[model samples]
Target chain A: MLSIVKRILGQMKNDKRSLGLLLFAPLLVLTLLFFILSDSSYVPKLAVYDMSEKFVAELENHATVSEETEKPEAADYLEDNEIDALIWSDSAGTHIELLEKNSKSAVALEAIQDTNKALQPTQKELIIDYVYESTGDNQLDSLSFVFLGVISFFFVFILSGMSFVRERFGQTLERMLMTPIRRIDVIGGYTLGYGLLAAVQSVVIILYAVYVLQLQVEGSVALCTLVMILMAFSAVSVGALVSIFANNELQLVQFIPVIIIPQIFFSGLIPIDTIPFGLGNLCYLTPIYYGCTALEMIMIQGKGVVEIWPWLAGSVVFIGVLFLANVTALKKYRRL
Target chain B: MKIEVCEVNKSFKQQQVLNQISLTIAGGRIFCLLGASGSGKTTLLRIMMGAIPADGGSVTVGGIAVPNRQLLAEMGYMPQNEALYEELSAWENLKFFAGLQRQSRKTFAADAEALLEIVDMAACKNKLIRDCSGGMKKRISLAVALIHKPKLLVLDEPTVGVDPVLRRKIWLYLRQLRNEGTTIVVTTHVMDEVTQCDDAALLRNGHIIARDTVKNLIAQTPDGNIEELFFIDNQSEAEAPLC
Candidate 1:
């Protein structure tokens, strides 16, 4: 074991560039996410034309409302989506013609709803008009977290797995095997090394999505990081195991859709509950299911580690199984 | 210590690679397994190195059975493939192998340099292995195999692709090691290399068709050359097996 540790340290020393990339790549991505995602305030520009004081006040309360002196100016504003909703009253029971510039129609829809409630006391049936999406819900932006979780796991798993496969293909694995090293030593060394890298990556991505990109993360940052690390471990182990079945780089790449896509389907990115029961059971077997579940609990529900331990435990077990599988698979070459 | 193989046989699915092969190698002697490309010489070496188990019979090395961990530590194996990491320098590769063998740091640096010098690669020690030529990579791999200083050295086609001058230098080093009581077992298809061995095992179709000193094998054959004896044995085996 001492020799194994020393060998692992030596490998790290030799491949310093890979080590640096593993540590700092995620930090750089997280910083970019921070700058791009944070401060996403939806200040919808509104245009009001020939509207009563009461109607204008209702629109102003819900959005950044502006008054248009000419019909052409209001038409231009509507065409450009400068005004999310326009209120123009000329005896047609105070018509509230809402114009949406952006597809995120929830805020504009909410503004229309608020205006209708205020007009209700006057016994006037305000006509609500929309240029697009008549029955669209205003909760679409809330789904970004699910996609973020999927993307994070995808990149981490592929990078970790490919790096490991490269080692095997390059014959470095054979060199390590020729030593007096145990099979367990190889698996443990790779897991610890890549696990450290993936953990840092997960933290950077999560923190960037939360603090930098300003995504809606209602849960504890620490819990999120913990869940991310667990997810990273699952990816790293799966990647290592997959490399065993692959003879070369091309074969390793062929596994992406077969191995990774199935995980995405089960990872709660899409509603797997709506699928058939037989197929849904298959989703439960995917590591991404548990990872995405834990991520959702921590990010959306603000769940603590105690609440998310079962999913975390599932990921840990999956990682452990994959690691053991890798060690056993290596026996095809060296028995010990 | 003596290494003995008793009627070992191995097959890959339906294709038999080795058949009823037996030999005994004494310590402080140089033994070469000479054969053609598909003669199973490397397979025999792997069995001795405990990398693969034989389908039939058993092998005992240093009084212990094959695949024993303690025995494995006392034996060094250099595989046919270049196994060092291409991204790392030759020095870095040696450091890693030495560490794995649990060599002391104080001796590791000087010993690694000496081994590189022996391989005529001391000048390119710090260059990335990926940048080195095929011969340089092979030399570094040989140095790594010798890092542990094992009593028994098993080399599988180590001199292939190496220039004639360098090959001779490597053989000279092996001879020096043999003088120091290190038992060397090398596999090669080159007919000329068989003359250098104290004892040679000529394998054909995975069987030890002839096992004796080069002079004895030559005297037994119609032609005096070791290559002629190998061809005669191989041709007879091919015809008999088909019939």
Candidate 2:
């Protein structure tokens, strides 16, 4: 029984990457979840209509507030937005329009009621206007925002890892090494071949998300697509490097958590700012972290490439390191 | 185009795979490394091809101490495993390997076609290797080994899964290549396969127990059979435990 177990483990030992992922993926994911769920405070954006300047100033101090005197514009703001509540003053009393299904809406309403209670005996009253009209949940935006990145990483990672695994299993990789071909030819050939495939995948996915899914991208579509392409290229390199340590196609798929899943946690949906010192900065080490960041910056934050250049450069550096690592790794199989 | 191994010693962890193994292979001749599994035949071949390094000593191909990049151009190696891409047709596999050496498909197209015909795989050259039989894969693997037209052909178990008919055809093809002045090194355990070579080294547990012509090896044995000679060599080693 001991020998049988040893034999099984010995087979696993040949695939060091799978073992590393088996140990490291859970630790990284736990770290991300601990930081993300720890913060519970909900801050609301308040839109006040025809309210007193004093009340607006006081409300601004407690929650994010925008004073709007225009009647139609204030009504539209109540109909569509991140607005937690809309405050208006009429002859009957003060009215508070609350965006329903928003947890912060209750918080916004309570702050106004508290202020009104403090001003008792001033012949004033407060009423709640619950807006049932859905402005479309921001939660979907948050989900889709990170979802684009996760999907891009998912497809490219699998394709590239399998491609390299096929090269090894077919023995064509060994044959290629036996030829007069240089190490650069082997690595560069794979990069060019799969890199083009990844580019096509990126183009289709990004275009479909933008045009078909109608996911709003604030920045230039060309630039957003460029970010995803760079992400795909880096993902391909990661797959190749990981492929060197995997023994089979099954071992290759085990890298999904180590390569793609962790990025979803550190993505903007989770508050990276609330994360503690050293662990927060550690998220920057993952290549997909940069991808998710750059995507969020373009699609949601309305930023150009100039603002996200540092993150994209980080991705290029990752690709360069993985390329060098893959070339050096071939030495283990052949002296040349 | 001469290949020589001198004092080649290799070890895997605590076990010695090859110890001071040496042989001289003449150009335009069929030489065989005759040994059973674990006798280090494959290790010795890999070292001479510069695919792996020996723990001690050196290998020279055409008077150039090997593990040299430029020298690799003249060396062709077919490993024990089937090395062709399953998804690709035989023609595509041949074209790719040939393109590695000459970098032009058109330049080596005729050479590849001729090699396929010699291996009796011309009719199925356009079929995907995934759909080919075990013998056909081995045949195309041989065709790929010769695709570059290297001066030295180092083949490890070239006829392992081949049928008897294809095996005979392979021996004839190896002889033809030998006549055309290509130095071929074939490794196998079957005693009859060694008879086709000009010179053969019978290895036992990382040592060359005997190196001689087929007739001389047979004449030296009391029973006068190649199989009996192999036992005589094995019994002597089995009696001396220190080796």
Candidate 3:
């Protein structure tokens, strides 16, 4: 088993491309996700004309209010894209003209509405609270936790799955079986070797997400990394087990839709409790669900290992079951 | 170490591969199993290696039962296909398999170099298996099987696609190993190569039609051509009479 680990790591050292993919693929995707999913603080620039100083001051809290001395200049500002919207009041009522028909325009309109509410002294202020104490970045922070679990699981699964399938195709598995090595050692060696790589991958991704991309984690980074490492091990074990049924690399790829994509759905894509028809219960069956849930607890909800041990325990159990399945699957090749 | 197979039966999906097959192979000799493709030669070899379970009966090597893990420590196998890590160099592949057999690093370097020299793969030791030619891969596979210096060596078609000169060299090396008390089992369709074996067995439709010393088996046919025995209408003429 130790020899197997040495050989696998040696092969990895030789193949620079796979090593690069293993370490950097998730980081690249996460960086892209950081850019795409992260919300930017977009403060709409509003051009107000014929508005009271007090009302304009209130609008400044919600938007960047710009005073317009000429009503005709409103068209110039809106056309030039310098202002998101133009607000003016007359004898009819207040009117707001939006520049572009996009999300920025909607933000400007929301700012205007907020300003109007502030002006109404008779209305009571509304206070909305979250059970988990969410800030403005909560949505992206929570989504990053899911991606942290899902993306690391995905790259490890495909790489390790393909590597094992190639081993079968090359007949090395058969050759290895002819030796005195036990079947369990083969699975264990592969897990330890590939699992080591996966652990490094998880650490790099988590560090890049937290320190570089500024992903806010309420709990200890070490604890979140532990969950991610467990998640990565599950991927390696499950990849090996699944490759047993695949005759070739293409056949292994076919399993992504069957085995991997469904896990993504259960990995916090849709709110588990909100999925119609009690399908949320299916999350327990997918390995990624436990990882994502545990990460959510640690990174978002600030829960410690004491509160999240069940999810961690669940991940360990899932990895153990799949590792045993991989060992049993070797029976098809060698009875011993 | 001697190998004994008795009444071994194996089938795949109701398709009978081996039926009540029995044989004995003495130690320190080269024993060849001769057959056409799909004649259960590979299956019988696999059964002997404990790679697949026999449906009935048993096989034993040196008093140890078949499929025994400890027994494998003393055995080496070279599959028909060149089963090698394509991404690794020939030397790395040798080290990996040698490591599995627990060959100590103190002597492995010399042993690996000598095996590579014997197989004429010393020049390509640093070349990756994928970059090597088909024949080079075969030679490396042979070297790997010989790396651990096992007591028993099983090779299936080890000479196919090899040049005649190298083939002669390999056969000479096998005889040398045999003389060194290594029990060798080989399966091949090469008629001339069978003459190099101390004993030979011919299988047709999962049954051994003849088993005898190469000299006696050749003399049984009308002419000296051993291939004639395979093409004979009634194979009973070539079968050795039971003691």
Candidate 4:
């Protein structure tokens, strides 16, 4: 196992492309998402017609408020997306027409509601609290924890899968098996090798997400990093296990849809209960789901290791099962 | 160790690959298995290496049954394909396999250098296998198999992509290893390469058509042409020219 680990590290040392893909690819995507997901830079355009001066003044602080003489014209502006939303008062409360399909609609609605609450003063402020509340300033800030788990697992999965496929196709696997090394050693060695790099990768990425990208972490950052490292080990084992069914790199890639995409979908990206039927239960089977769930508990809910050990155990069980499966799969190549 | 394969049988799905095949190879000699493509040469080699199980019969290296991990420690094998770590340099690849064979790092450092020299790849020892030419990769792979100086060396089509000059050098190295009591089994379709071996087995379909010493086999064929032995019937498919 140590020899295989040494070989993996040696190969990785010489493979600049794989190293670059494994280390920097997730960072690049997250950085791009950092800029795109943060809503602080966006200023919503609001068109007001027949609204009181006090409410418009408060709304002005939250948005770029435009005054209009005609309600139809303001509605037309919202239709054309010239304004994110239009506000007017009639007999039945105040009407706010928001442009559909524009992401700016939610921002506009939140700004209007805040402005209304501020101006009314006595209109009771709803102090609703959740069991687990989002602490991020924006959606991405909260989702960044999940991204850290998903992205790290994604890249590691691809790297390990492609590398294993290369070994099989290049026949290096056959050569390795020809040695006196136990089949389990090959699986263990890969897990350790890639798992070591995954630990480093998790540290760098979690630190980058927490310190560099300023992703809010309410719980211990070390706990989150541990979860990510486990996810990566699971990714390595899963990748090797998946590669057994693949004949080439392209076939390995073809598995991404079947093996990876489902995991991403079920990794709490889309609300599981919202999914039709009991398909959401499939999330329990994906390693990334447990990883993302554990990371969410740590970074967002401020939950510690005690609260998340089951999730971590889920990843551990994944690694163990897949490791055995990989060992058994090698029976097709060499038995013993 | 004396390698023995007794009445081995192997099949894939409905198609049979090896059928009632048996052969004995004594230690300290170069034995060659000669056959055309798909003639079960690779399958036979794989079964001998304990890579794949035989449906019937048995293979034993020395006195131990096949697939014994400790027994494999005394054997080195080179598959037909260049099964090497392309991302690693030749030296690094050697170090990895040598480490698996449990060769101490200090001893491997010297043994690797000498093996690289034998394969005439000392200068390119640090070159990555992917960057090396086909012939260079073959030489490095050959070096990798010899890195541990195993008691039994199994090579499958080791000289396919190697240049003639380097081929002669590798043959000489095998003979030298044989003299040092290494049992070597090589499989190749190349007829002239058979002359380098002490004994040759001609496999047709899944059966051994002939097995004899190089001189005796050549003496049996008319015109001293080994190709004539394989071409006794015109109905045989067109084959790569055999010298």
**What are the DockQ scores of the candidates, in order?**
0.40, 0.24, 0.66, 0.75
Model 2 pairs whose backbones collide: none
Best TM-score among the predictions, by candidate number: 4
Per-residue lDDT over A107-127 for candidate 4, one digit per residue giving the tens place of the 0 to 100 score: 899899889789888877778
Candidate 2 residue-wise lDDT, A129-221, digit = tens: 543221323333444446666666666677678867987887777777787778877777777666665666667666766675455677788
| Minimal lDDT window, size 10, model 3 chain A | A133-142
Higher-scoring candidate on lDDT, 2 or 3: 3
Q: Could you tell me which residue pairs clash in candidate 4?
A: none
Off by over 4 Å in 2: A1-138, B233-243
Candidate 3: what lDDT? 0.90
Q: Candidate 1 on A32-138: residue-level lDDT in tens?
A: 54445444467666677777778778767777877778654445667686556666667556555554434545667667677778778777766886432213121
Off by over 4 Å in 3: A40-125, A131-139, B236-243
Tell how far residue A98 is off in model 4, in angstroms. 4.4
TM-score of 3: 0.86
User: Residues B83-146, candidate 1, lDDT per residue (tens digit)?
Assistant: 7777678998888778777778999988988899889999999998879999999999899889
Which residue pairs in candidate 3 have backbone atoms (N, alpha carbon, C) closer than 3 angstroms, thus clashing? none
Candidate 3 lDDT over A154-256, as tens digits, reads 9999988998898888878888998999999999999999999999999999999889888888888999999999999999988998898898898999999
TM-score of candidate 2 chain B vs. the reference: 0.92
For model 3, what TM-score does chain A reach?
0.81
Q: Could you tell me the fnat of model 1?
A: 0.50
Ranking by TM-score: 4, 3, 1, 2
